[model samples]
Target: MRQYSIADLESRLAPSPRMPVLFVGHGNPMHAISDNAFTREWSRIGADLPEAQAIVVISAHWLTPGSTHITDAPRNRVIYDFGGFPDALSRVPYPSEGDPVVARAIRQQFLDYEAQLDAQWGLDHGTWSVLVHLAPEPTVPVLQISLDYAMPLPELHATFARLRALRDRGVLFIGSGNIVHALGRARWEPHAQAWDWAVEFDRVTGDALRERRVDQLLDPFRTWDTARIAVPTDDHYRPMVAAMSLLDPDEDLSFFNEQIDMGSIGMRSFMTA
Candidate 1:
């Protein structure tokens, strides 16, 4: 396959409003209500990104057993799925409106999966935390799609690829999850440095993303021993797969927030145009 630059990707999608896809490794829930470096970058990204007609977020926080669900409500409410966080986080609201039309369209497009329209399960920290900085006013229609926890990485990739049709339709997709999220092994201090294995896993993931070898990421636990420590669970790692599935062989990719947090969480994020 031939690699394409940003210009080539833009030229190929000529006359159509093609939107780039993003994968954000949202680390701490505190970033939602706090004004930090990550949040500031999210704001800058919001300003620099192309104006999207609608936004769809595939968050790691929303996981279903055997079926996928898409938010179809007219309006979205914040779902504080996490606990032990500050009270301020609970008070923060993102009330982004939802587009049933677009949500229904997504359901129809994902014919290979058991996709269903859902009225409940609002935006989780994986979404609103970033959106609170990305789109402060939150006027755009936003939708959240659930990940089928039982699906394999390959099937999840194909299921998410179905959304590629919406790229030219002015829909922006955001996959929110961490590449390395070993929460149990994290150092809780503020000045903690990343572990060696965590850094190595992140580097490997970055290499795969830059070279467009997304297949290399499907089973990191089997490929690298470090992955067992970096990705003990699939929840966070799966969102990266979902985001990668949206990219074609000829798109330009760029990284952001390339750092590990609390010695474990890899906050490396990327965008494919």
Candidate 2:
């Protein structure tokens, strides 16, 4: 396979606007409402990033059994997907308008079956929690792309590749989920340190991401036991695969918020232009 540069990737869809692609490792919902380092970084990215016509977030929260769906609400309301959080967290509304044109562009990008435009779906925790920090006002049009868990691996990867061209369409694609999300072993206390296995798993993932050996990520069991402990489910880890697919060989890579929190959640994020 040919390794394309950022320039080459944009040239394919030249004359269209181009923007950076981001994979944000959102650890906890509290990060959204808090004024901490992580949220500060997110807000900084928002201020620094170019004026985006639309933002398409592929969140781990909205999982589909068979096919993918894109949120198409003209004015999307926040849907508090998680429970047990404070009422203020649930009441937080991220009212980012939807773009039908961009949504259509996303659907049309597919070579196979088209992605469906979902009117019912709203901003889930995986998406809004991060976006609220990134785009506080969120006046920019925001569309969400749901994960099709039942889709075959090769096919899902192919879909991610197709989504890369969206950058040139003035759309910033964001993958929202942690690299290591082991809620079962998470500590409730703030400033909790990461476990040894969590550190190892995060390091391995970062290495794979930097080396462009993303396929190795699909099968972690043969590589390290720590990875098995890190990723018991695909929801969190799968977003990274999509992020990897967007990588351009010649583009500069940037990472931020490299801290692992609550013992298991790896708050490691990266980006490429």
Candidate 3:
């Protein structure tokens, strides 16, 4: 990939119109390098997208309290933030540059919300795994916003409301996490049966989104039947809530790769206008 200075990159990105927001159920780390159905769908999603100014990813793996972290280095590294993967997976690199100017813009925009620039945090599997399929060339500048683990659902929703403006500026805000993630239930069984709880939870969640019921969608733990099993931890599902809260009612929504993975986990990938 051709390396560009942060200034050069930001200058090129500033004038474009905002890209759509995506909520991707990025399942396992192995999907990063594998040529599977989900990977093909991700590639198709990228192929269909309009050019973006920059990408702000709210990945499931990086969570913090009150603060959002943005990568500001000129050359960002690929984080092998997973274990027990093949050595070739570790060797895979997506050397996308980071734009400090854009990072600063995000920081200033969320000044009251306490945004911080991190030099050390690189692209985790929640990021590169999906991006490797989304933008295989790795030419687009990328920044990641951390989930405030301590905040309530409403607070996170409000934060996303402030972030809605970035959509018009050509930045693609992506929330990458599974809607039905039960770590204990996920298995490699080729013919595994879909757990009833997982099915019910994913269906209810999808229905709520389709109905534009933001409140119901935000409070999944209360409204959904399988919150405990589906969302074993809030870290993986909160990012989706953050992204969904930013969507406009009039925005066009499309669900791609709408299926269950490992029998019970939803592998749905969706985009909003």
Badly placed stretches (over 4 Å) of model 3 are 1-13
> For candidate 1, which ten residues in a row score worst on lDDT?
6-15
How high is each candidate's TM-score?
A: 0.93, 0.91, 0.92
Q: Which is better, 1 or 3, measured by TM-score? A: 1
- Candidate 1 residue 258 Cα shift, in angstroms, is 0.4
Q: Tell me the lDDT of candidate 2.
A: 0.80
- Arrange candidates by lDDT, descending: 1, 3, 2
Relative to the true structure, candidate 1 reaches a TM of 0.93
For residue 117, give model 1's deviation from the true position in Å.
0.6
Off by over 4 Å in 1: 1-15
Q: Which 10 consecutive positions of candidate 3 have the poorest summed lDDT?
A: 1-10
Per-residue CA lDDT of candidate 3, range 137-234, in tens? Answer: 85668888888898888888887678787777778888999888887787678857778888888888887778888888777778876888888888
Two-way lDDT contest, 1 vs 2, winner: 1
Each prediction's RMSD to truth: 6.9, 5.9, 3.6
lDDT of 2 by residue, 137-225 (tens): 87578888888998755567768888776777677889998889898999879788888899999998788777776567766667768
Find the candidate with the highest TM-score and give its number: 1
